[model samples]
Each structure stands twice: as C-alpha cells, then as structure tokens.
Target: MLFVTRSLPSPIWLNGLEALKVTGSKGKGSTSAMIAAILRQLGISTGLYTSPHLLKANERIRIGDRLISDGEMDASLEWMLALRDSYESRHSNDNFGAFEVLTGAALYHFFNQRPETIVCEAGIGGRYDSTRVIPGRITALTSVELEHTELLGNSAELIAYDKADLCPDGGTLVAGKLEDALLPRLRAYCALRSITFVEAAAEISELKYNSAMMQFKMSCAGIDYGTIETGLVGKHQARNAAVAIQAVWHWLQCSKREVEEQRFTRAVREAFKAVRWPGRFERIAEDPETIIDVGHTQLSLHAVAETVREMNSAKPIMLVTGVSYDKNVRGILDELLPIATEVICTRAYHKGSPVETVAALCEAIRRGIVWKSADTIEEAMDLAVSRAREQNMTVLVAGGLFLATEAFVHLSGGDPRLLQFF
Candidate 1:
C-alpha cells in the first residue's frame, strides 16, 4: 500500500510537506479543521483532509477555505485509478478500497497544490488507517473511549495505545483531556517509543452559547488566549479548540518556525471565530429550531445530548436519529432516549442501521417515548418538522454521519440521494 502512494508522480513524502495527523474516539474532524484554520490565519497555505464528509467527497480534501475543485478531483482520481490498476496487475490478490483511493487522491491533490502544511484526520484507529502515510511529525489524540473494539481494543488504554501509533519515533503526541487511569498508560506507551507526550490543558471559563454562536475564554500554557467565539456549539468544542491550539503550537515548534506569543494568540482567536465545521451541533433551521450533529459513539452521543439539554432546557425535543450498523445501538439510545419527547427512527442511504432496529432499541430502553420509524431521512425530517411545529419543540438530528449528512441535505432544500459516501 505504501508502494502505491510512493509511485504517485509527486508523492506527498517527497514534497517536503509538514503534516499533522489527528486520531481519537471523537473530535478528530473538528480538531483538524481548527488546526488548519489557525495555520491559514498565520498566512500559511494549508491542506486539510478529513473523513466522513458531510455532503460531497470533495469536502474531504480542502486547500485553505476552498474545497477541491471538480477538475482537480477528477484529475487526481484518474491518476490514482491508473496507478491502482498498474499496481493490482502485478499483485492480483491485493485490491484498494474506496478510502485508500480517496486518501491517495487527496495526497496527490495536495502534492500538486504544494501546501506548506497538511492536516489529516484519521478515519479510524491510527495503526491501520489510510492517512498514516502522511508522515506527520505531530499527532493529536483527542479524547479516547472504548470504540471500534474489534479493530482498536476493548479497553480505553488499548484504544489510546492504538491511536498513539499515529506519531513516529522521536515525534510529539499531544493529547486532549484523558481519563486519570488511561493517561499514565498512554504516556508510558509514548515514552517506550521515544515519543514526546504533551497533555493539552487549558483553563476554560465564561463558556456561554446562544442560537448563533458559542463564547468562551481560554488560557493555555501560561498564555491567555482571550475571548474565543465559534459557531460550533458544546463545551466539548472548547476542549477541541484547546487541543487544536496546543497541537498547532507543537507543530510550529517542530517545523522550526518562529512563534511569537502575541501573534500566535491573535491567530488562535481569529481561527476559532472563522472556522465552520458542519453537522457538529450545527443549526440548519430556526423556525422550529433544527440542529444536526454527527455523533455516533456512545460518548459522543452523550456529549451532544448534554449540550442540547443545556441549550433547550425549557423546551421539549423531537429526536430524529439513526446509527450505522457497526455502532453500539443500545448504548447510543441510552444516552438520547431520556431527552427526546418524540423519537423518529430513520436510516441514512448508506450503511445506516435499519429503522426498525433502532425503533426496537428505543422501545426496549424507554417505552412511552412516542417513537415512529421512517425508511429514509427525508421522511424522518418531514415527520419531525410537522410534530415539532405543532408542539413547538426543538429537533435534533443525530446518531451517525451519513444520517446527519442526509438530514442536512434535506433541511437545506437539497436532494439527500445526491450525497456521496466514500
């Protein structure tokens, strides 16, 4: 697989690109976007690659604020297809998956653009993820949890160790707030591999939010970053922002770039203000108040539920949700069922759990929740909107990335069927 990437006309490794890889049970995409935003604010050309895009596959590969153009995507895909054919001709048994091809195409596109820095979010565990070929010197492990147990491990320590593989020997691994027991084991694992482990810490205060944005104050590494505001909601985002700042701080030091504290602080402030990541507590409508968040894991779903509870404490909520086939359905339902006055179970067009399955779990967990099932996200949205309008309740679309993407498209007056998954 490495050979295939190396065979590209302009391989990413050969281009002297500085890279940062983010891996975790959650918050990888948001943290990667925040890092790229900070670098761009510092006047550096940056490329960002994140998995499970909200709408189109092109959203996975971005240069600065702009997504990859159709022409660039087509060219890169064509080049990758030729290389894949040639490589598979010689090794007939080995075949490339969609994610591998997409990763290669993104790197190939970045190689042409020649960005000074590239930030990539690992699609899954770091040890076997496709983005591991980036040669990132600085890796950020945002909060760990027991997820992807079959591939990553069953315990928190094992999962943290699996994600720690993103950083190479002599590199830096900056971690977000970790559990007390797991931190020491992760730190020791990094020490064994000669990797510098930096735990990200910040004094976050004055955290408040409204319909439009969230505001907070952060002081990290003995420097006051001042008031930071972002469209992304939730206390977890403040933590993600802290991790992003620390990761970028280490990245600057690793690249031998001058990091004036005042200028860096200013960049962090501006980056948070401008960064816009969709489907993570994003409000797509306001009449009845509809929000879409792509939080599939148990921990992530709990966080989303907590944030929604905080915001709409006085109002009832209409929960329109779905999950992937591989997720812990009952665990995810346990987090959300208590908050939902009315539940609508729906499936995304790709890899979503059956609506009947989610509906059954909802009933088993907490009966009398007034739950209904829809075969598609569109139908779910229609039902949720009608019910919410009559009850004047808030609607939350969550549980999986694909379901959130489909709901986002439907809410934005677009065709959910047109959404791409890779």
Candidate 2:
C-alpha cells in the first residue's frame, strides 16, 4: 500500500508506519538503534531508520538488524520515483528533495515488510522532519544543543521545541539529560499536551562504565530493570541507552502487550551486550589502538574527550580529524586539541572543509600542540597510525560521519563503492 499525503508524497507513505521517533542534535541515532536492538532481541520483527549512513544508504534502513538489501532498496526507490513523477506531472512548480523521496521510499518498503515495530531517528528538527510523518506513538528527545541555527533557530529552547514537539499528544515521551534552561520548556510542553514524560537520566542509577562497556540500572515508571550492560562505551551512551530502554518500555505499555519482567530483563541485557552502532567510538585496530567516532559538534566531542581522559592510558593520544564544510571547525578543534598529544588535520574526499583551510586553522592554534596537515584522509590516517605505533600511543580518527565512513573503509578493507552517496 502506497500512503500519500495530500500536498506531498511523504505523509501518504507514512500512513500505518507508526514508530517511536527520536530527535536531537546528537545521540539520536545510537538511541534509536538501541531501542530497535532491544526489541529485536525480544523476538519482535523490528525496523530501524537512521540518517547520514557512514557507508551505504541501505545502512539507514534495517530490518531485524540487517540492512535493506540492494535489490529491495532499488525496488523501493523505483516505486518512489514513479510516485514522485506522478506528483510532479499533476502539480506544476513543485518538486521533492532527496530526503523527502527517501523517507517515502523507506516507509513504503517497511509497509511491505511489515515489521512488528519501528524506531526512527529524525533528520534535523522534528515538526517538519520527513520522518515526522510516521505518526509516532512515543517520542524521545536526546540532549538539545545549538545546531542548524539558520533553519532550526538561534537558541536551545527553539531546538528543544522542534524536537520535543515530536512527542505525540497523550502518548509517552522519554528524554535524555537536557540542559537546565531546556527543561522548563519541555516540562511545560509535556504538561500541556498531557504527555507521560519520563527523564532517562533520573531513572538511571549506580552507573558505571569503562572503555569496553557501560553498566547501569534503570527504573522506568516504577519498574526497575535490573543492571543493564551495553557494549557501547562512553558515559553519553549510558544515557542514550537509558532513554531507549524507557522509550521501548513505554511503547510496549502503549501496545498493551503482556510484559514478563524476567523475559524483558534478559532481552535487554542480551541486546545491549551485542548491540553495535558503528562509528561511535568504534575500535578499528589493536596495534596503536585505532578508534573512530563520528562526533562533529563540540557537544558530541566532549564525550570523546571524557572517555579518553577516563582511560588514563600509559600511551599518548594522537588524533586524525576533519570536519564538514558546514560545521564549526574552530569549535571542534578547540575541544580536541588539548586532549591530543599530536594532531593531523585532513579533509575527507567528499564536500568537506578545504584541507588548506583546516590546516591553517590548526596552525594558528598550535601554540605547543604539535600538529601536521595532510592532502587527503588516507595520508593523515597513515601518518597518524605510523606515529602512534612508533610512540606507543592510541590513534583517534574522528570528525564528521563521512570521515568515519572513510576510516571504516580504509581500516576494514571494505569495497570502495561503500563510499558512494546513495
């Protein structure tokens, strides 16, 4: 069944594609993936839709932990293109963008596959996000921060509204640890809408984490999910998982499904232990300990810094970093420079910030921070890894998610077509 919106193709395709939508400037992808993983472990057929795929576009849409196959994705795209052409032919002076078409295509494909549940991560803000068409039963807002100011607004409160507004009226809303200033607005929004609001941070206690795993206990709606362990490292992931656990529980409650406490606990533990959200603090190699994280913003990179600090490794930390052209290069560099023993600035093959531009910025702020510039990401990775091995230091390759894609390809010996935009 092809769902169609009156004015656009997306809203129509989203009909019956109900999901738990998660939105934020950061952590939403990980949070959504965690929710899907837990549900899948429960023997539920689950669909997870996330954004900015590191390798392939199909990676953005998954069924039961497997990405949509190339053949199926192609078929879905063909169907969507037909609808797009029909819409354009009938209505002049209007055309859909890539995301709008892709959203419709994803929903259409999911309709055919008919997963028992879906967890979708919104692209950009919520109210107008293409994924918003899903008519979500549960909404999750991860930490709100300043981002996409031109289109989203200039303040944190506005961004929070765009995200929090995704929560369905009279449905469930689970949130991560938000800024103090954002809480009042969110609380008022939930209260006005009669949303059953739960704070993920508040429900979590006895939190403990290491480089390899994070452990925590979450009490959701007075239901204590005993000690949960997630393979995802860093303190931020614990918070993300907490939000996912609460959101999934609330969604289950909405579905009126019978909940077996022991079974639920077991499923959650097993899922977290095996759940893998690639490019988020992913360890690519053992020698010199190479790591890659798709942390583009300062708020996101802070977690990376904190994780490195907590490690207290005897080895030094070397960084290979770059950013998208649209990102705040200086801000990201500021957060990274102090944490690195040495830095190699480079540009990804895509429409990244100019290599010379990043090199110049790094040079200006060097002070005592030894740094170098590379013409390409490969050169930078090679140099960083070589130096790291020689010095017995850990290598962190980070920046935009695109950089993560490149690093993953280079380190894993994956196909080059994985780098192509879908």
Candidate 3:
C-alpha cells in the first residue's frame, strides 16, 4: 500500500523533518491544529496537514496559519500526479488512492517550505495510514471509539492499538481521555514497545466549558498552565487542547529545547485561544443563529447536543443533518433528535446518506417530531433558514463532514461543486 508513495522520486518521506502525528476516532484534527498553533506562537515555522477539507483542498495543507495558495497547491498536485502516472505506467498492478497522493503532495509542499515542525492528523486507523510514513517522534491518540471496524477492528482496544502504532519506538506517546478499562492495556502496549506514555487526562484538571468559551488548568513538563481559555466551543476541545499541549511539550523535549515556564505557558494559552478550526460547532450566520457542526459519530453528536443545549436552552431548535453511508445513522440521530423541534433530512453532494433513509430513521425514533426531506443541501438550508426565522428557532447542522462542507459552501455563497477537490 505504501509502495506507491515510497517510490516517488526524492519523496518527502525521507526528508527527516520533525513531526507530530495525531490519530483517533475524534479530536485528531483539532489537536493537530492546536499543536501547530502552539509551535507557530513560539516562533517556530510550523506546517499542518489535516483531512477532509470543508471548502477546498488547500485547507488540508498549511504552513504556519495560512493555507497553501491555489497556485502552489495546483503546482504540487501537478507534480505529484505526474510522478504517480510515471510510477503506475511501470507497475500497473499497484496504485495509490487519492488520499495517499494528497498526503504525498502535502509532504512535498512542506519539505519545500522547510518548516521547523509539521503536525499530521491521520485520515483513519493509523497502522497503515499514509501519514505513518513520516518519521514523527511525538505522537498522540486523542480518543478511541468503535470506528472503521472493517479496516481497524471491532473493539475499542483493537482500534486503540491500530492508532497507537503511529508512535515509533523510543518516542513519546500521549494518550488522551480513554475508557477506564482501556488504559492499562494501552500502558502495557506502550511499555512493551519502549515508548514513553503520558496520559493527558491525568495532566488536565478543572475542565469546564459553556457557550462562550472553555477554561481549564493544565500542568505539563512540570509547569502549571493556570487558567487557560479557548474560543473553541465544546468540552471535548478542552481535552484536545490538553493532548496538544502535552504533545508540544514532548516535541520540544525531543528537539533538546528547554522551555521557560512563563513563556511556554503564555504561548500555549495564546495559541489555543487563537486557533480556528472550521466545521466544528462553527457559527456561519446570524439573525436566526445558524451553527454547523461536523460531528458524525455518536460521541461527537452527543457533544453537539450538550453544547447546543447550553447555548440555547429556551429557544426552539431546527435540526438540519445528513450522515455518510458508513456511519451509525441511528446512533447519530438518537443523540440529536431529543432537542430538535423540527428536522430537515438532506444529502450532501458526496457520500451522503439518502434523505429517505435518514427521514425514515428519524420517524422510527421519535414519531412526534416534525420532519421534512430535501434532495440537496441548498434546498435544505433555504427551508431550514426560512422556518427558523419564522419561528425564532436556532438552526443547528450536524452529521458527516461532507454534509457540513456542502452546507458551509451554500451558506457562504460559494459553488459547492466548483471546489470538490478530494
């Protein structure tokens, strides 16, 4: 599977750049962003690579806080496609997927930029993920859940082990909040591999969040980061921030850099507050107070429900949602159906579940809920916004990433099909 990427001429995988690889069922993207933000805040040239961009392919690759320009991305993609074509012509039996090609292109772009550090979020299970080719000395597993059972495994421990493989021997592995039963097994796995394991849950305390922001106290590398506040809305983000802080601390340690407590604390505080990750409980509009959250998993949906309940307990909610075919649709619907007064079932342009399927499941779950179906996200958005304005209800969009992408593109007045790269 990795041969295609490995066979590229002068591949960036051999660049030997310092990297922090993050993998989990959730929070991996947020954690990767936070780590890059902290490094950038501390005067380090940072490159970040995440997956499933909300708007364009450029969002998947970043140098410091800015995304790669369209021209640059196109040039890199052209170069990568040429190399892929040349390789495939010689070896017709083996070829890489779009994600692998994109990963190679992102690494190539990063190599040219010569960033001091790079943070990569794994696209799926980490054992054979394309990003695993990077020699990342600092790795973090944000949270484990039952996901990609066909590729990873059925149990939580199996999924955790598959993700934990991202951490190399003699490197540092940071474990975020995991189930109580899974901790000892993770610890044993780390100990056996001679990896230094740090539990992020143990390092964070006094975690709290509301509609405005999240505040927490973190102690990492023997420094007390007192009273940190982040603009990212959700308690889960607090946990992600903790994992990122620890990963950054270990990254510095790996580079033989000493940290000043006050300066490091200030950098971490500012970086977390300033980091912006779109499609995670993001508010795209006003008047009716529209929010779009790309939480397809049951756990993430539950977090969405918690945040929405905290933000607008008194007002009615108009739920607009669509999930992918592979997701646990019933579990996702179960999390959001209770708080929603009106439901709009819609499908994104790519890999979205059928409107009929989602509406049927919604009906089966709660018969009293008023539900409607839309073949496209635009129609759904128009219908949801109109009804929300009429009844003074909040529009909450939740479900898969593709659905969020389509909704965001529509609400932002962009052509959804125009920027459907990857």
**Best candidate, lDDT-wise?**
1
Off by over 4 Å in 1: 10-15
Q: How many pairs of residues collide in each model?
A: 0, 4, 0
C-alpha lDDT of candidate 2 relative to the true structure: 0.80
lDDT (tens digit, per residue) of candidate 1 on 59-85? 899999899999999999998988889
lDDT of 3 by residue, 223-291 (tens): 788888887777678778889988998889898888786888899899988888888888788878888
Whole-model lDDT per candidate: 0.88, 0.80, 0.85
Tens digit of per-residue lDDT, candidate 2, span 1-422:
12344433344434554578999889988898889988988888888888878777898888986789999899888988988998889778977778888787787678778787788888888877877767668998888889998878899988887777777678777888888777877888788989877887646677676566777777665666788787787878877877888888888888777879888878878988889888898888888799899888888988888877766677788888888898988888877777888888888887679877877777777765646788777777788878888889889987777776787787776643347764
Q: What are the candidates' C-alpha RMSDs?
A: 1.6, 2.9, 2.3
The candidate, 2 or 3, that scores higher on TM-score is 3
Off by over 4 Å in 2: 1-17, 203-211, 216-223, 414-418
Candidate number with the higher lDDT (2 or 3): 3
TM-score of each: 0.96, 0.92, 0.93
